[model samples]
Target: MSHSTKNSHLSTTVANLKPSGIRRFFDLAANMDNVISLGVGEPDFVTPWNVIEASYHSLEQGYTAYTANAGMIELRQEISNYLKHRYFVDYNPDNQVIVTVGASQGIDLALRALINPGEEVIVIEPGFVSYAPAVTLAGGDPIIINTKPEHEFKLQPEQIEDAISEKTKAIILCSPNNPTGSVLTKEELIKIAAVIEKHDLIVLSDEIYAELTYDEDFTSFAFIKGMKERTILISGFSKAFAMTGWRLGYATGPREIIEAMVKIHQYTMMCAPTMAQHGALEALKNGQKSVLDMKKSYRQRRNFVVNSLKEMGLDCHLPGGAFYVFPSIKSTGLSSEEFAEQLLRKERVAVVPGNVFGSTGEGYIRCSYAASLKQLDEAMKRIKKFINEL
Candidate 1:
């Protein structure tokens, strides 16, 4: 008998999962001296003082214990109000919302609550890294629908139609998408809405970057005539409010689905951190100006980074939203992984390999503009020098 079978009884699903391509690059750069990283898709901004102070105020008021399993009613109400005012989507705070430990936990809760074994969920790539793995871990099979660069990486209605099968249960949508920074236009989403209605599929819309759009206004999937009932709307303060460390996020959907996810969350997560929930409430209620300030800065950085890459002979799309620009490295005659690896090794400037998102991402690399212009300028110079040498 093999020693592995006898001694290590890990779940085969988890054991076989590939580690995150983004984190692998991050880890490699961590030990190196003076590596300028455009790898992780995280905000470089600190949480606004008012939001941080709110958490402190909560602690001062002895709000240390867990609140309701669905999270503090006040926080949920604020989320409800914000959703309504900002996106015109009304979700009942009392029954249709549950606070989570960041958008990631909300995503996992939704998948685990809904996915049955052998079911398939469609995940668009190059997309966020967590979508497919979360489905697999929930006992669902992931079906990748490769969104093409020429199409600006938006999931097309026809692609959705082609990928749907009897076993297909849901589709994940992220706009102002990570890795590519493409936002789905309202017209584009309407077409997807039609397909969703035809297939009777559930939609897990990751709108965590909802407030970070640079050009077009964001359209919530729930706003699509009849999507509210079939969509799990997940969002948070992490990006817009620069409250990533606060770890507060929330999900809104049909009451039944929200109830199911809340039940799982009650036993596992209990509630999002009490202080963080209070902080999130404050962000929803009073953080608009701060959000705008950060968005403006991100926009400037985006223009600079995108233009610089194009000038350096890299083909980069002007990202419509979010903070990343995915540029093709095909002309460099290097595979995406090879390009990212050699760039990091030679220039000490770390970027994530686009192939990590999926095979459609094979000839590109994702660069984040969340860093300061000085850092971006320095990194761009290094990248250009490296490419020129090649």
Candidate 2:
């Protein structure tokens, strides 16, 4: 049958969903050549060589078979230990953690496990694109709480409290946040923790960039007092380990919640790729050295791009973690979407429009500094020239 013939029953869920603004802009840039994309918020670094070697060894050792729905016990233990070592959070490997396809699926699973029709999920503005759609797909209302640049794009405890209503179900947080790259201070998280405690809200904390902190040690919501029972901590090897294609990530939370998520997982994914899990297990065990090295390179790029943007008169801040800097182009009196389009057309440089993140994300553009310094230098030169023209 033709697509049009079968398209009639397209679930309203899928039918009504608008494409991600980030991906729309990215798609527009994909066909153009001589283009530099700082848009995709991905590490340009290759997965470390040793991790690849381990994957080969695992397959050669005949380790290619389905694992448990939650994933291999040994791999789970490694993830548990890795969490303890890095974040001081303790979770039982057997019950608390579930190996996911990536932090991406972990987001979907958390939503699937929690949302009911019309229940509100509070999402931080200028947040990653995934949270809203995931919540919507699970039949939840996405309540956006816009955070401003003046506030460093950090969530205020008061704001959280205000957004909550009787129908509120959860709050999804990302920091070193994408687009903006803002890290929440411990004090800020502590404040938010109190509100969640008061409201008893489920917290889905996506901390995939936790290991990329530059200014201070990254803290986990999982480690926060009273959060263990209420928070679902989603993290993955993709960002920190430069293993984006590996498609391995995991979540730790209350057993009941995880068990519920695994029910969805069993039908949706069955199991994460066995070879990828093996690689992720290796990543947890020996990935730290590689993570640190990749982080070192990224830190340099962050400083280079952020500083260059400032020298060119863009209102940008040095972000605390992650490899992106969201710089304001408001002074130019153009919408971020317009600025981004012009930058690509005139300079052939691709950066995500901040408005794509949310309404409050307007007047700024998000550029990932995950590329080589050489590419960044060329891109910066083009950007400087482009801005000068305006």
By lDDT, who's the top model here?
Answer: 1
Which runs of model 2 end up more than 4 angstroms from their true locations? 1-7
lDDT of each: 0.92, 0.90
Q: Per-residue lDDT tens digits of candidate 2, residues 41-70?
A: 779988888888888999999998999999
Kindly give the stretch of ten consecutive residues in candidate 2 with the minimal lDDT sum: 1-10
Give the number of the best model, judged by TM-score: 1
Candidate 1 structure quality by residue, lDDT tens digits, 1-390 = 332333568777777787787888888899899999998778899998898899999999999997999999999998999999999999899999999999999999999999999999999999888999999999999999999978888789999989999999999999989889999899999999999999999999999999999887999999999999999999998888988888889999999999999999988988889999988888888999999999999999999998899999999888888889999999999999899999999999999899998889999999988899999999999999999999
- Residue pairs whose backbone atoms clash in candidate 2: none
